[model samples]
Target: MAATAVLQPYNEAQYDHRAFDSLMDVDESAYYFDSLTGYEHLRSGLRDIFMRHGVSDELAVALLHRHFEMSTNEKLVELGPVSSPWPIAAHEDSVLGGHILPHTWRVFENELHPLEFRFIPQQEFQDARKVQFSQAFFEDFRQYVKANGLENVVGITQLDHGRDADESDVQLMEVTHGRNSIMVPAVPSSDVSGPAFQTIWSFVEKQSSKLDADGIQTRHGLCYKASSTDAANDGIQTRHGLCYKATSTDASNDGIQTRHGLCYKASSTDAANDGIQTRHGLCYKADSTDATTDGIQTRHGLCYKANSNDGIQTNHGLCYKATSTNTTNDGIQTRHGLCYKANSNPTTA
Candidate 1:
C-alpha cells in the first residue's frame, strides 16, 4: 500500500530527532530507483541509506531488490511485519510477495499549511537556486512551530541542498524534533545550494528539553554574497517549495536575486514574508528593492516579539510614531490622544 511519505518500514523501535536529521541528506549512491535517467546515482544513494540505518550489506541488498520490485508492482500485499514488527530481514515476511517493504514515511507536520504558505513573501521562493536566508527565516520557523499541529515537532534544524557535512551551502531545510523526523535527498557535495542558513530556536536541546517545554533562542543569518552585479531576477519570487534569487554573479551559485538582502523560503503551504528589514531590533518592511521609499513599513502578524518595535507610520502617536495633529481645541474631541493647536488661531479671551 501507499504511505504518505516515501520511506521503508521501521520497527517499533524509537527514533531520535538528531539521527533523523542526519538522514535527510540521501547518500546518493544508495538509492536504486531510476524513473529518471539517474538510476545508478539513486542506487548508490540507497546503499548509503542502508549504512546510515546501520543495516548489514545482505539486508541492504534485499532492501534494494524489494525496492526494485515495489517500484514496479502496485498490488503489493497489505499485510506482513512491514506493518508493525518490521523484520530487518526480507525473507522473514512471506506475505509481502517475498519483498516486504516498509510504509512510505511522510512528515505529518511538514510542507506548509494552505493558509500559512500563501502569506510567504514573493521574493522568498522565486529563484530557489540562490537563496541565502536571514534571522527572519528562523522567526518564521518559530511561528511554524507554534502553528504546527504536531506538538512533537519542536523546531527546524539545518536546511541544506548538498552534503550533510557542508551546512554552509544550505538552502531549503526540513524540521527536527525529539522523536519525529523527515528525510530529503542530496544534490551534490561540491555545490552548495544556497550557502547560507538561519537557525530559529532558543537552543538545540535533546529530546529531554523539548519534552520539558523550555524554549531557546533562534540565531538566523544569511550568507554574504561575494560582490556581484546582477539584473536578471533582481526582484523576488516565492515558489512552491524553495526561496531563490537569480543572483547575477555570486560565486556560491545559490539562487540570489535581490541586491541588498538575503532570501528565506519555506514549504509551499507556509506563509511567505518578503522585504523584511531589522533596524535597532525592529523589523521594517520594504515594498521592494526597486521601490524608492523604504520608510513605509508594517508590523507583526498574529503575534509580536518583545523586541519588535514595529508599527505603521502615522502623523500621530495613535499609530506607531508620534505625529502632530492640529485641532481647534474647541470641538468635541472624543478621541483621547496627543493633539496640537493651530499656529495663529487664538482661543476665546
Candidate 2:
C-alpha cells in the first residue's frame, strides 16, 4: 500500500493554534510514558518511519523523544501514516497497533520544517560544544516569544543528549501558563554557532533578575587588560558575557598595591634620598632621624627635626628662660642650655 493512501486517523483542524495553546497547559506529569517497554516500541516504530522517509536516525530519535516529552497525555502509542491530501492530523484520539496516539504528526510528503526538525551536520554539532551561547539564538528565542505571546513568562528545560552517542544538546521553551512550547536547538543554527554557550548562558543569568518566574538571569560588566598606569588609558575590550578589568597593580615594595592604597617608591636610590614618603602622606627629609620629630611639621605642634636634633623638649617639662645661671633658678637647664622645669624633682649638681 502506498504511504499516502493510508487513512489519517485525526483531523487537520485539531492541531491548529488551539491545540498548540492547549499544550501550554499540560503539566510536567504528562511527559512520563506508561512503561519502558512501551516507550521502546513507540520509539522503534517512529524510527522506522522516519528512516524510511530519509531522516537521520539521530534526528529521528531526538524528535521522537521531544514529541513524547511534550505530549499532552502520559500514554505511549503507535501512530500510523496519514493519507496524502490530509497527511497531517492534530486530534489525539486514534488507535494504531492497539495503542492510543498523539494529536499531531508530520507527513512524509511535506518538506521538513524548522518547527518540526533540525538537521545539524557532524562538524556543526562539534562546533556547538565549544560555544556557550549565541546572539542568533537569542534573537530567534526573542522572536519566538513575541510571536507566541510568551513575552511575560517563558521557561526553558534542557534535555539529555540523544540515546545514541550524539552530544547535540536539545531544549524546549514553553510559555509557563499553557502548553505552548516547542523544542528548539539548544545552540543557535549553524550560521551563528561560533559563540561559546557560556556567553549566552551568562547573559541569560543576568537578565533573570527581571523575570518573575524561572527565567534566565544575565550578568553584565566590562572586561579588559587594564593599562599599567591609568584605567582611563585602557583600550576597548570585548566579551560574550561580562567584562571586568584587573583592579590591582604589582607592589612597589613587597605586596600588591590596591587602587588608592598607600604606596612608595621601591628603588633604593629614591628611598634613600626621598626618605620613604608615601604617595599621599607627609614627606620626610633624608637627614631626619628622630622617630617623633623627624618628618615635616604637622598642624598639631609636633616639631619635626631637620638634622637629628631633638630640638626644644616640650613634652615632659616647662621651659623658662633665666636671667643668669643659678641652682635656685626655678628651671633645670638642658644640654642645649635651654632651662625648663621638670615634671619631677629637678636634679641639682
Q: Write the per-residue lDDT of candidate 1 for residues 47-88, one digit (tens) a residue.
A: 233333332211211111111111111222223111112223
Model 1 ranges off by over 4 Å:
1-197, 203-216, 219-257, 261-349
**Stretches of candidate 2 above 4 Å error?**
1-15, 24-32, 35-38, 61-349
Clashes of each: 52, 31
How displaced is residue 57 in candidate 2, in Å? 5.3
What's the TM-score of every candidate structure? 0.18, 0.18
lDDT of 2 by residue, 230-297 (tens): 22434311111112233333444354222222234444444574565432113345454443444343
**lDDT values for all models:** 0.23, 0.24
Worst 10 residues of 1 by lDDT: 314-323
Positional deviation of residue 297's Cα in model 2 after best superposition, in angstroms: 75
Q: After superposition, how far is residue 287 of candidate 2 from its true place, in Å?
A: 74
